[model samples]
Target: MKIKTCLIQDSPVFFDKDKTLDKVEQLTKKYAQQGCELIVFPESFIPGYPRGFSFGATIGSRTDEGRKLYSEFYKNSIDIESDDIKKLEKLSRSEQVYLVIGVTEKQQVNGSLYCSMLYISPSNGLLGVHRKIKPTGTERIVWGEADGESLVTFHTEIGKLGGLICWENLMPLARMAMYKKGVEIYIAPTADSRKEWTATMQHIALEGRCFVLGCNQFFTKSMYPEKYRSLVADQPENMCPGGSVIVSPMGKIIAGPLFGEAGALVAELNLEEIGLSKLDFDVIGHYARNDIFDFNVAKQPEMVKENPTPKR
Candidate 1:
């Protein structure tokens, strides 16, 4: 099967979930009109990635101003059950394209947040969501970790699509689990835009022998509100310089390394290459020696949370 996919590297309407979603709608229609089958966005592109600002927080000190900033961030985040998700569903169906986007997903409970991915199908509406199983570094302060229930792959008209947020791509067993489920379009939505990030995508495409779609946001100090600009004033140009890219089954860059730029990088992918490449080094098939490696992926992450013997 041949499919056209788009990676959105545009900046979000920083700190405003409603405005960010509005931008997403416009972009969705723009690409759908250009004939994209699936469109992916960067991590936490819904409201924004709180890149540089610590919100006046420290190890043991969260000031009143910090709490106020956190509250503002919380208010700007989109809940999974919110009208924002419904609007995304409607956009996917009306645009006739699959939608894969990253957002700061607010939980219904006390408003805990997670860096989440939404997999919406044109025909299936909102198929499922993949919440980041673990937050990286300082991210743990704001985002709550999810159980494996969020590790998911969705079947679509194009192919079997799935994703992991940012550094989770480094999870060897997690990648194997997706490869085991036959993920063809492996979407990675990340906040990291370093040149090395592109290499990671290429490696994954080669390792999983699957098409890799990597999306990142191109953010600058100016992207933030006037009041918060001073907080990011010391930052350099292209604070979150984009490196959104797409790699083929052969680990070749077909679309872009769109570093320091913000736009859609679209490419037409030949899914047959997946099967052809798998014949050479199938991760789970002819290449596997199950006797030497006994791996288990828990259906419910909670079931194995305490097991802690290095499993996804």
Candidate 2:
């Protein structure tokens, strides 16, 4: 089967959920009109990424200002079962296209938040959600840890759809688990916009022998507060310049390095490439050495405790 994927490279609505959804709706319509099968959006597309500063840092450097800003932003975040998700589901079905988009998810019970990716089917049904295993650095202060039970790949009409959020792509064990499940299309939604980020995606594509649909946001210094802007004024060009790209199994750039724009890059992927690329160096195939180096990963706490820890 041939898969057509589009990456929505755009600036998120800085800390505003309603405006972000409005932008998403418009972009979804545009991509659907163009006959794209699936569209991938950047991380924290809803309510915007925190950028580099605390939410309400201006009120006071210490005290309740930072907490107040976080609370406000959290309130703006979408609940997984909210009306907005229903609207997005309807849009996906009406457009007849699969959507793999990221959002800031707020838990209804405890009011804690999570960085989550939602997979909406063209049938207007909830497919799956993968929360970031670990929030990067300062993000930990605002987001909660994801449950180990949430690691899963959704079986969609398009293909074996699975993904890891942002820096989770750097986790070797996580990548191997996805590979074990035979993921054909690996969706990587990220906030990293450095020039080397594209190279990292290309490397993952070649290593997994699967199509990598890497989508990143196109943001700028203006996206954040002036206090935050002053710190990175030296390299303003890459504050969050979108370098979204799609790579084929052979590590070829098929779609884009779509920098400095709020748009999508559509690419047609020939599924045959997966099989073609894996013929030589399939990680689980002839290339694997069972006797010499057996790498085992266990999830159960009991199993983990029993196994010998590897030396650094």
Among all windows of 10 consecutive residues in model 2, the one with the lowest summed lDDT is 300-309
Q: Report backbone clashes per prediction.
A: 0, 0
The C-alpha stretches of model 2 lying farther than 4 A from their native spots are: 55-62, 223-238, 290-312
How does candidate 2 fare on TM-score? 0.87
lDDT of each residue in 1-312, candidate 2, tens digit only:
898789999877777788889888899999889889999889988877766654444432554767777787788898988898898889888887888888889998988999999988866366767888899987887888786545667666677778788898998887876776678899999999888989989989988888999999988777664545664466565478888999998999998888877678999988898989988888766776767877654541110111222347
TM-score of each: 0.94, 0.87
In angstroms, give how far residue 290 of model 1 lies from its true place.
0.9
Candidate 1 lDDT (Cα, 0 to 1): 0.87
TM-score of 1: 0.94
